[model samples]
Every structure is written in C-alpha cells, then in structure tokens.
Target chain A: MVAIAIARQTVREALRRRVFWIFLIVAVFLIGLGPVLGFLTPKESQTIMRSLGLAVILLAGLFITIVTCIYLIPVEIERRTIYTVLSKPVQRFEFVLGKFLGGFAIVFLSIAAMGAVFLALVYFQGTTRGPDAGVLVWLTSGKFPKEMVLGVVLTFFQMMLLAALTIFFSTFATPVLNFFMSFGIFIVGNLSSVTESLTTSKNGLTSAIGKIIHYMLPNFGNFNVQNAIIHPTTEISNQGVFIRNNIIYALIYSAVLLILAVIIFDRREV
Target chain B: MATVIKKYPFETVRRRMSLLPAVLAGLGLAAFMQGQIDPDAKQFHPKDNFGKTANGGLNNEFLLLPLLGFREAAAGLLWVRCDEFFHSGDYDAILPLVRLITWLDPHAENVYITGAWHLAYNFTDANERSDRRYIAPSQSLLEEGVENNFDIPDIKFELGWQRYDKIKDFKGAEEAFKLAVATKVNKNSDDFPYGAPLKTLHILAHTYEKQGRIPEALEEWKLAIARSEEMLARSPKDYSAKSLHEAEVRNYAENIQRFNNRYSTTGHDSVNPSPYPEVLEPPPGSADKTPRSWDVAFKPELRIVRPKVFKVGGQFNSQDGARIDVRITDWNYQDRKITGTLNDFSVDPAQTILIDSISVRKNHFEREMDMSKDPKMYSFSQDFYRVVLSYNPRTTAPHLLDRFGWSGEGMTDAEKSHVFMDTDPDRTGTAYIEGQGAVPPVWDGKTVPFTNHSQPLRLIKVTYKISREQIMNQKPISENDIVSVQ
Candidate 1:
C-alpha cells in the first residue's frame, strides 16, 4: 500500500513536469507530418510513413523516458520527500521500485498514445494507396502494416528498460550526471551490431571486450523491429518466440537494475 | 579490532548473491535475442567511408538518422533528389545516387526500375540517339536489383522489359520473365500477397511468341489463364482484382484458342509451318541427301578513321534483308559469354564492351561509328580488342525473320553458317532428330538445360582481332585484319 501510494505520487509529480509533454507533443507532430512529407517518394511513401512513425516514437520515447525517470529519485530527495516517505513505513526497495514503476507508466502511456496515432496514420495511408485491392482484405492484414504493433510494443519495452536504467542511476547520481551516464549507455547499447561484429573480431582483446559489453548492455538494438515491420515481406523465422524472449529479457534486466538500486539506496546516507 | 568478526555478515553476502541468478538469466536472454535479432543498426556503424567512411562504404554520422530506423524515409528523400537530377537532364549524376538510394532502402523497387529506365533511355548522344553504351550499366543495375529483391517480380519484370525493348534480346527477356513468373507474393505477395503477379505469366507468353516457341507460348497462355482463374476463384466477389484478372483470362483464353487453331493442328508441331527443309542423308544418290546451301557470301570490312572511331562496311547478298551486330570487347569476352545459357543483364565493369547493330541496305552497309565520346563507357585501354561482326536469325531484320525460322532453318552461308540440333533426351549430344526438324537449336541462348556449352550461334559471324594501336591510329587499318571465326 505504501509503495502504491508513492508510485501514485511519483506519477502525479512526473506529469506536472513540462518536458514530458514537450517530447510527446513533438513526437505526435512528427508522426502526423509523416504523411505530408511522404509526397517526396510517391511509390515508397507508405513505407516511409510507417518507418518514420516508429522512428519518431522511439526518438520521443527516448527523451521522455530519460527526462521523466532521471529526475524521479533525485527531486524527491532534494525536496526531502524521500524522508517523509521513508518515515511513513515505506521500505527503501518499495520506494525505488515505486519510482521505477511510476516512470515506466509514464513512458508506456506516452508511447501508447503515439502508437495509436501512428497506426491511424498508417491505416489511412495504406487504405488510400490501393484502388483495386479491397480495403477489407487490406485491413485484415494485406496492406495494413499490422506488424507495426510489434514494432511499437518492442519500442515501448526498449524505452521501459531505459527508464529502469535511469531510475537506478538517479538512486545515487545527480539528475544531470545521471542523464549523461544513462544516455551514454543507451547509445553504446544501440550499437549492438557493432558490438556483435567485434565479438567475432580477429583482435583477441577487442573480441573479449566486445563479448563483455554485448552481454552486459541493455541491448536497445534487439527491440528494433523497424526493418521487419516496414518490409512485411521480410520473414522472421519464429516471430512469436523472438518477441517473447525479448520481453522476458527486458523484464529480468529491469528487475536486476531495480534490485541493485535498492541495495545501494539502502546503504546510502540520506 | 574485532568489528570484522560480526556474525551477521554471512547474511549480507548471501543477500547480495541472491540477485545473481536473475542477472545471469537476463544476460543469457540478452545474448540469445542479440544473436537472433540481426539488428539493422549495422548500416549506421559500417567500417568504412571515403573519409571517416569509405566510398560505397558508409559510416557518416549525419547518416545516423537512417541508422536509427529511418532508412526508408532517407531513401525516399534521396530518390526525390534523384528525380530532380532526372528532370534537370543531369543524367550523369543519377547512377551514383541510385546506388545510394538502393543501399538506403533495397525494397524501393521503383528506384531500381526508374533508375534503370533512365540509364537505358535518357542518356543520349548529340543527335538524341540513346548512347547504347549505357545499356550494359542499366542491365547490371537491374540484375543487382533482382538479386537484392528476389521475392518480388517488379525488378525481374523491369529486367525483362529492358531485355525486350532496349537490348532486343528476346531470349534474355523470356528467361527474365520466366524467373519473374516463378516469384510469388507470399512469394509474390508484394501486390497479391498469395501469388506471383499474373502479368509475369502474360509477358512470358508474349516473349515465348517472340521466340517462335508457339507450343510453349500456348502453355504459358494456358498457365496464365489458370492463374487468373485461380485468383478469380479466390475472390469471386472482389470485382476489382477479379475484373482486372478477368480481362486477362479472356485474352489468354482467346490466345490459347488461336494457338490451338494455328500451331496445334498437328499435336507434335513445335512451330507453325514446320521450320524444316529436307537435309537429306548422304548415300551418294539417296533422296535424304544434304541439300545444297545458299551463299549470302558475307564479306565484312572495317577501317579506323581516327582515334576512337571506325568505319565498318559489310556486304550481304540479301538487300535490306539482314542486320549486323557489330561488337567490340575487352580482349577475351566470348570466353566469358559462352557460359550462362540466358544472355542476362550482367555486365562486368572490369571489362570494356560496346555493341551496336546496323542494317544491310542494297547488299552493303557503310557507317562510321564514333566512340570518341563516352570514354568512360568504352575505355579501350586493353592491348588487343576483338571486333565481332555477326548476324543471327532471331534478332536480325524483319526480312530475315520471314525467311529463316527460329533455328535458322531456311538460311545458310557457305563460309559462316553452322546448324546444330539436340539429338537425345539430354542435350549433351547434338544431331538432328529424324522427323522433328529445326524447331530447336543447339543453342538459341536458352533450351539446353546444362550450364557449360559452346555457342554455335552465329550464322554469319566474323571476328577480327585488332590491336588497340590500330584503334588509337598508331597502326594503320588493312583488309588483312579480318580474322575468320572458325
């Protein structure tokens, strides 16, 4: 009950901030403008719109996730709200988990909102493309890029993981420092392909380091379903299993980060 | 001093080690997903560019947007720029940009198709004649396009049309269309999502007709009808898709009936009017004796007028009844050409090649071909260049089309003609079948299912090996330069 109350308070406090709204509004505007800008390539307009929509969501989700979550624990302690919450019989672990959850909820809700707009734009654009192809059949799965749902889901979880990392950093680090530290990790993790290649690299030292980084990082690249989503013809051997594995991995990693954060916060002098 | 001896310290260590299992599992899943998800992010992190990256190899930081999953949009924008290049008559600027757009988004089928079209059609000479030199590059681009996008028929069809309209290689067109018809949406889904595009089959039928493979043409028409009928059956209520295919079905059915009436009169006939004259057997005075051959007596001559320019004159007995394919190759191209049965659109850039055709008017054709322009396309930098002057029944003028059948059955040249036909179930051996006649050739760039074979294709082909010095005007041209092709 204490954690839930802290979580609710965290959510309310995060919403009052202006930065989250800025990212969300900008994201929506970019996604909406995807169609208007699609006139550049008449043939590939639909593909561009779909890919650009997901990309906008990811960019927006990146900023929204980091900005909202980075300040979660720092502001509370700075305002002495952590003392009041801790004095009210809330365990340190619950407080940490609550902040992470609250930040995650904001990211999820924001991405979901953007996802709806992306899908609506894709559907409208897709339906307009085919004069002969039946709209109902296209709607069923033909022309409609239903795989973008997976793209959006994957983006949400990717951002969710980033949020967890931010909260963990915020547990000890200042907001500004936490922002850079977490953003640096996110950028490195996005270079999953680079890390993967180096894992098999000829230079033994590089290979060893690559293996370490590849396994230890959040692996933001795994959730990039943009190519497979944009090109529906691209076959993923076993999509369901693939997505299930990624979700489980993200959840497990998020749990580990939160646990570590709690352990640190428990020993930290307030 | 005894602070380290606290007994509760074991619990702390145990508690810290408890999350290790979760961390291990997370790491394990991360490894597995990373292995499975061949991330598209590599496009952003390549090893080379011309500067910080390699030319054709990219690592531009500004290219980071495409790296972040906006590749198709980037490709779209670049293609728009390519369009501007096209409109401004900056044709030279389009090829490299096409390479970029295709790299950015390989699924942009229209980019490959349009870029190839521009390469083949728009690049022109001072007199507005298409620079035939660009044909090879356009073909190579389409071949690469087809290679990159095997599941879609669009590039394959574009290649087929390129072979058909641009190069006039009907055999190559047939092969490309055959490949196209084999593509499906699920295979061929791009448009249909469940089947290969029906037009692939329709065009395949037309290409077969052009090749004089009337029986195969009928078969393709029937296949087209069957495919359209299947589509119509799947969506009987879908007036739009069905109506579109319905017209095709009617047309194919009419063609099938027409083919059955004209060529299928004899169940065994391959082409109409049976492309056979009695090549009689040799028994001294036997009725099946090999007939005497007609001598068109081809005497082709060439001379270098100036640097990168040549005057080619060819004499034939037939007035306006023949055309000569004049070809210049980088030292040894036929050694490469003898391989692949289909004369596809794959031109290697490492070698220089130029091919053009001229019609024989009043038993002779004399024209000066200038290769001084477009040095990039025809860099005759090799020491020795081989010039081939040839005529084939399939691609020659309409007058020849009327006299000679698909296999050059009715035509003969004393010093230049060679006729061959497959003798057995496998085409390893070549000889005439007793009654089947000349419907099939030993090689017409198709039919002979094997990979390795020599081309006995030219009926009147003369190859003259000349030094590049002669082309550079260092060695003077002479009549003795003509080297008869054995």
Candidate 2:
C-alpha cells in the first residue's frame, strides 16, 4: 500500500514537471500538422497522416521516458528528499517500482493523447478529396481502428520498458550519464537483431560476443507493428499471440531491470 | 582519532540477496521471449541483409540505424531526401537514395515504380548521348520492383511500355503486357481505374500486330474488344471515349478483312480484283479478234470436268471426261506454246509433273491427264494439286492469282509457294490456267461456270471422288498416255 501511495505521488510529480508539458504540447502540435503534410501527397494522405502522427507519438514517448525517469532518483538525492522517503516505512524496492510505474503512467497518457490526435487526422484526411480517401473509407469508418489501438498499446509497453531502464541507470549513475546510458541501451536493444544475425554468420570470438550481446540487450524491435497498421498488406496473421507475447516480454524485462535497480539503491550510501 | 566502525545489517544484506533469484528469473524469461519473437520480426524490422545484395548494398548507417529502432523514421527521412534529389533533376544521386529507401522499406512499392520510371524514361531521355547507358539499369530496377511487388500490375505495365516503346522488343513487351493484364487488381481502385486492364490488352494486341503475328494479334484484339465493352457497361461515364472504342472495333474489322482476303475464296473477287483488261474470244478456226503484243490483254476461260474424288494409285479414270478446257483470244494463237507443271504439295520436287507444249488450235486448247500413264508420278496422296502455267509471255511472270494478282508487288518464288501450300488451306484445289478454256463446260449433267477474268489467268476448282480399293490395285501406265493436244 505504501508502494501504491508513492507511485501516485510519483505520477503527480511527473505531471507537474515543466518538461513533460512542454514535450506534450510540442508533440500535439506536430500531430496537428499531420493533415497539412498530408496535403503535399494528396494521394497518400491517410498514410502520411498516420505515419507522421505515430512518429510524433513515438519520439515524444521516448523523450518522456529518457528525460523524466533518468532524473527521478538523482534529483531526489540532490535535494536530500531521499532521507525523508527512506526515513518513512518505505522500502527501496517499492520506491524503485513506484518511480517506474509513475514514469510509465505519464508516457502512456501522452501517447494516448497523441494517438487520439492521429486518429482524428486520419479521419479528416479520409473524408477529404485526398488520393487515398476512397481506400481509407473502405478500410475504416467513423469508429476506431482496432489495429491502430493495438499499435498504441504496444508502443506504451515499449516506452514502459525504456522507463524501467532509465530508473535502473538512475540508481547508480549521475543524471547526465544515466540519460546517455539509457538512450544508448535503447539503441543497442533496437539493433540487437544485428548481433543476433552475426551469431549465425560469423565464427569464433566475434560470434560468441555477438551471441552474448544479443541475449543481454532488450529486443525493442519486436514492438514495432506500426508498419502493419499503416500498410494492411503487412499485417501479422497471428496478432493475438504476437501482442500477448510482446506484453509478457516487456513486463519480464522491466521487472528484471527494476529488481536490479532496487538492489543497487538498497546498497547505496545516499 | 577513533574511526566510527559502520555496522552492516545482516538482515538487509540477506534481503537484497533474496531478490537475486527474481532478477535471474526475469532475465531468463526475457531471453526466452526474444528467441520466440526475433524470428517473426515484422517488415519495419526486416532482416539486416534482406535487400543488401539486390540494392547494391545499403550503407552501414542504414543497416545499423534501424537496429536503434527508428528504421521507419530513417526510411521516411531518406524518402524526403529522394524526393529532393528527384525534383532537382539529379538522377545520378537519386538512384542510391531510392535504393536505400526501398531497402529500408521494401513495402514502399511506389518508390520502386517511380524510381524505375525515372531511370528508364526520364533519365535516359534527359540526355540523348547517354540514353543507352541508362536502359539496362532502368530495366534492372523494374525487374527488382517486380520481384518485390509481384502483385502490383502498374509496375508490370510500366515495364511492358518500356520494352515496347523504348526498347523496341515486341516479344518482351508481349510477355510483360501479358503479365500486366493477368495481374488482378481492384478496377475501382485509384491505381487501376476502369478499363486499365482493357488498355493493357489493347497494347498487347498492338505489339503482336507489329511483330506480324496476325493470329495472336487477332485473338488479343478480340479479347480487348470484349473487355472494353464490359468495362463500358459497368461504368459508362468512366469509359466515355467512344471514338477510341470505335477505332479499336474498326481495327479488328480491318484485320478480319485482311485475313479473309488472304485465305477465303468467297470475298477475293471484291477485295482483290484482277489488274488486267477483259478480252472476248473469237470463233474456233476463224480470224482471231485480239491483238498480239507483249501487253495484250488475253482473258482466259477455264473449266474442269472430273470425278469429285480420285484414287491416288489407280487410274483417275472418269467415264464422262477428266479434262481441262482452255480458250485464248489471240491472233497469233498458232504461234504460241503453252507449258506448265502440275506440282504436288510435297517437299520433294520429283513427284511433280512437267507439262510440255500443250497444243493449241485456232483459239482453243485442251489438256488431259490419265493416272494410268506414269502412275508413280501421279501416285496416291490425299492432298491438293496446284497448276503452274507458263506461255509465250513467260518472260513476264505467269499471271497466277497467287503470284501476280494477290500482291501487286512481285513475289519471290518462296512466297508464291507459301501461298499455294499454306496460305489458304481450303482453296488449294482452285488451279490457275494461263489459256482460255470453254466458256461453260458440261459436268455431271450441269454446265459448270468459270470465274473468267482478264487477269491472264483463270481459276478452276475440280473435285475427284475415288475409292480406296481402285487406288490400291492400279498398275503403272505408259508415259505416252499423258496427252497434250496441239
């Protein structure tokens, strides 16, 4: 129950941050420009609107995770608020978990808002005399698209995973260093497939090191189902199994990272 | 100074160590999930080496940036850059960028098609001196597009047009157009408007026609007509170009006329009239009525009386009369000599008969053939026989309907043979005679009419009815029985 209260306070604190609101407003503005960009390629209006909208949401979600979550513990320590928190009956594991949940909540809400903007742009682009208007109307109506909703959910899971990594880094490193380290990990995780392929193609030490890196890094590439949503031709056949598996994977990885953060914070002098 | 000794809490250490198992479990689960999901990665996260070879190898940045989980963003950036290069008329720079864009997002079929078009048409036409250099690359790009997006007909249509109009390869154009027509896409869709498929068929027919593939061209034209009509029925507003449709209909009709003119006998007289003047025959043994000159218009009348079917080996003996009547309207008829041959449609020339100097009296001549004479030469064969006639004006090639009249331009010997042996399979029995025969010859108790014209040659078709038993037992007769009355 203490963990739940801390988690709520963390959410409130994140919402209060000037950086969060600034990024949110900027993301919303970018999404609002989607319909204008769509006019440039009137034939592909729906595709352009959806692609740009999703892109804004993804970049905004990443910024929230990396910037907000990385500074959580460092700011708390710098201001000596950790003493007050630790002085309470709060456990170190609960604090780390709360911070992760809080960051995730902020990112999720931002993405949901951006997703709504994206849907509206898509709807407007469809009804207009755009090139793909006919195709869009045939594919979707006034109602929400389930596939797009699924995409949003997967994107939330991805951002949550990134938030956990940031929290883990904040436990041991300075805010600036933690920011880069977390962002680097996200890059490496997305490109883990490169090393995964290397393991099968190369020989000796290179292959062995590639295999280790492939297993150690998070597979963020798995969560990118935006292409399927944008181009129906590439939609996955077994979407149920895919979404379930990815959710499980994100939860497990985040849990593992959070556990490590808790262990490190428990032993820290601060 | 007495250093304060830090008291380590054993319970806290033990509790931290207790969470180690959970960390290990989480890591294990992550590894398992990675293994399950990696193999089924989506298009945005395509295999690093998916299009490396075909795209001439993407740069390390492209191959690696997507691993950072922003492949779509990178592809979008490349697409914008490519558009810039395209608008600036920098085709040389556009190639690599378009290749990278397509590699990053192979599902961007529009990029492939537009890129190939730039290379094949726009770039090549941009510089006359370097046109040849771009042709092969353009074709290669289109081929790659086809490989990646086989379901799209637009790419195939572009390729077909490239081969047809730019490359002048009709066979290749036909193949690509065939695929374009066969590829089924939504007609109502923007990519394929109504009558798009019909247009493809029309192009295919035109290509076949250009190659002189008449039969195939006719078939495609017919199909296009039918499809165009269907399209018009479905969406009249969309297919309101009635002049174009009527033009296609007229083209089909013209082709049908040409085909009939070459093969059918019923419509030959109207379309292919003789280019010679008519001549009236004089009384037998009386003064000839026509002048004697190299350009003398000698109208010949020919008649054939015979058994409709004849035994090949046995004598082609008709109890009534198996003979050809020839009448000429000439003053110097006694000075003229008629010689020709009855050639079989066999590859061997030894099976043909050489007719030498058929005798003429006044203005009339008659030739009779009895298979009893030289049965080996007139041996049994269920095939049509063609007569080749030559007379005093042999220097001016014989006026056979096939050799002199079918085409005003002179024909080679091989072309003439093709006309007799292959052109009209049903009209092979219609033989041409250079001399005039009886105006009307009696046959089977009826006067058989002759198609007499002043073309210097007359056509006479005769049918011979023969029993198989008669042909099997017939003996070879003396060569003297082949008579040429003078």
All candidates: TM-score: 0.77, 0.62
lDDT of each: 0.68, 0.57
For candidate 1, lDDT tens digit of each residue in B316-416? 76648578878877666532332211123333435567667788889898778888786655677788888888776656553454344333444567653
Which candidate tops TM-score? 1
Could you give candidate 2's per-residue lDDT for residues B289-392 as a string of tens digits? 45111121222222233332221222111111212221211111121111111011112212322222333334344444333333333333433333323232
Per-residue lDDT of B127 in model 1 = 34
Off by over 4 Å in 1: A38-43, A126-144, A197-208, B1-56, B112-148, B156-179, B184-195, B203-218, B232-322, B329-352, B360-366, B378-385, B397-399, B414-458, B465-478
Cα error of candidate 1 at position B362, Å: 5.4
lDDT of 2 at A15: 87
